[model samples]
Target chain A: MKIYEFAQAPNCRRVRMFLAEKGIKMEYVHVDIGKGENLAEDYRRRDPNAKVPVLELDDGSHIAESVAIQRYFEEMHPEPPLFGRDAKEKALVEMWTRRGDFNMMFNVGMCFQHTTGFFSDRMRVFPEFGEESGKKAVQFFSVLDQHLEENRYLVGDYFSVADIGMLCSLDFGKAVKLRPDPAQYPNLVRWREELNARPSASA
Target chain B: MKIYEFAQAPNCRRVRMFLAEKGIKMEYVHVDIGKGENLAEDYRRRDPNAKVPVLELDDGSHIAESVAIQRYFEEMHPEPPLFGRDAKEKALVEMWTRRGDFNMMFNVGMCFQHTTGFFSDRMRVFPEFGEESGKKAVQFFSVLDQHLEENRYLVGDYFSVADIGMLCSLDFGKAVKLRPDPAQYPNLVRWREELNARPSASA
Candidate 1:
């Protein structure tokens, strides 16, 4: 099995970090997003969305999207149970994971794309929208900080995929010059520090 | 055993439809989003994100996010298997569900929020950003049209929650005056009609 991805992308990093956390290793095939290789016909056929981090199964079938790929691996290697352990915990993990992905990670990505013009050649870029997206990402930081004030992780205690999603997005937020302020979000800062200390964080 | 939601909201509708598909019934507590009831301190305490469709479990704990709520039910009622039947199908369903939620539904919702200023009292509104989001939604409609040309549902034959999300969002697109045109996206229109015909579509 191989994964087609651009290693630099946060979405790809999410899957990599997930694999590292699960102590699983797989072949990686680079599709250079910087060179617009992902937008090519071949890659687009592989994933109609043409997004990075498409996992190729042993049957030659492809699964696109980072969360979907992570789900596949989590099902295969249920030992660590990154998704969750039970029904209620699983729902909470899914909730926080989507929140991190949609609000935090997605806003950071929008800010990067619109403000940096990195993919301006491929899609329309609105700097104003990017600025607003930056603010949105920061707003979620406050919410996350408030939540983390009492909880060890997003879903409480368990270091699930929710933490992985937030960690990668928060790390990628550097590109957009958006980070949770130390004073404004101390809990978030503490959580980030703890997650960064993990070896898989660099994956 | 209770769901806090506004019936008209697309996200809330997604959950309601999912429960209907599962043949499960629960008491509904209405939250008037039009009156900003969702932003009230009590509601915010129930869901820090201040979003509707929070499922209050028998234990009195709450689960926010439409997909997460549906997941809790899917776990309880595994017979219908709205998520998927196996690892591969589950991944595919997850991929499509997220694509619909993040790409199609999110863009449409953004267009409505930014253009209509529906939440202007609480959030910033950028009409230009909304216009771009409308275009993005339309782009996904085209992609969906092409995919639906062959597949009966988002993840092939089974009518999973992925289709539920897309159906709800597409219906909500009416608020932003965005719909898949039959002339341009015949396949999407066809698929939409079929799903719309389902009794659960109105739930």
Candidate 2:
């Protein structure tokens, strides 16, 4: 198997970490998103979405979406199941995963797009809505702060994909000036530390 | 089980369609998102994120995220599954489902929340993201149109959750001036009509 990846993207990093945690080895092909390599016709065929972390299976088929890639890898290698065993447990993982997706990850993308004008040349039409995305990221931090208050992980007691998804994106959020203020988010502070302690978390 | 839903929300309507297709019965509790009811303490306990289409299970646990809800219901009653059977089939369903979520449904929420400002007060402080959200949504339609050109349904020949997710969202998109130009998206039009022809699609 091979994975087309980008270095700094949180979505790409999530896939990279999942591969490390599961002890699976895949040929890694770096895609240059900054240089517009992903936009080329050849890479577009690899992923119609033209996004990073496209996992090409040995059978020649591939999976897109960071969460789906994690699921696919977990399914193919079940020794350390990041998604959990039972249906309800899986649902809990998914619940938190989606929460992070909707709240933190997506909003962080908004922050960069709407405010920094970092990717403006690549796609610049949404300048009007850019800063609004940054504000929404702040709002997302508050909600996540509340969630982290009771649960050690995003879903329940165990560390799972939800943590992975949030950790990567929140780290990226720092680049956009969105960080977890310890004064406002104690729960997030604790969980974020635990995530940082893991070796693969650096991936 | 009782569903807290709103008719205008494609996410909420997804659960309705799943139940209707399975011939399952459930009581409905509509949360007036327009009135900021979902942000109140009572509803927040049900779903901290304050989003709709929450399913209060028989066990008294609550489920959020339309994809998660669909998975739970499908597990509870597996006959005539909305998610496909077998690993490859299931992957196909999930692959397309997330496409709808990422490429289409998520953008629909952005189009509404970021552009429409229908629930900006309740959702958070900013209303400008709606403009970018709306444009991102139209971009997604083009991606879907390209996919529809090759596949009969979103995944396969049969109706699945991917179809459900996309159908309700695009229909809702029309209200926000995000309609797919029929001339450009002929495949989408054909598939949309084909999907609507189903008894459960209208839900």
For model 2, the stretches where C-alpha displacement exceeds 4 angstroms are A125-128, B120-132
The estimated TM-scores of all candidates read 0.97, 0.92
Q: Candidate 2's error at B7, in angstroms?
A: 1.9
Report the lDDT tens digits of candidate 1 across residue range B48-155: 889988999888789999999988888888868999888888899999988988788889988999999889898888888889889999988889999999999988
Across B1-203, the per-residue lDDT of candidate 2 in tens digits comes to: 78898877888888788888888888989788888888899898899778898888888889887778777778778888888765556666767777777777776776676566676665453344556567777777777788788889877676788788888888888768787778988889899888778787765
DockQ of each: 0.79, 0.48
State the TM-score of the second chain for every model: 0.98, 0.91
A139-160 per-residue lDDT for model 2 (tens digits): 8788878877888887788777
lDDT of 1 by residue, A54-161 (tens): 998888889999999999888888879998888888899999998988888889988999999999888888898889889999988889999999999998899999
The regions of model 1 sitting more than 4 angstroms off are none
How high a TM-score does candidate 2 get? 0.92
User: How does candidate 1 score on lDDT?
Assistant: 0.90
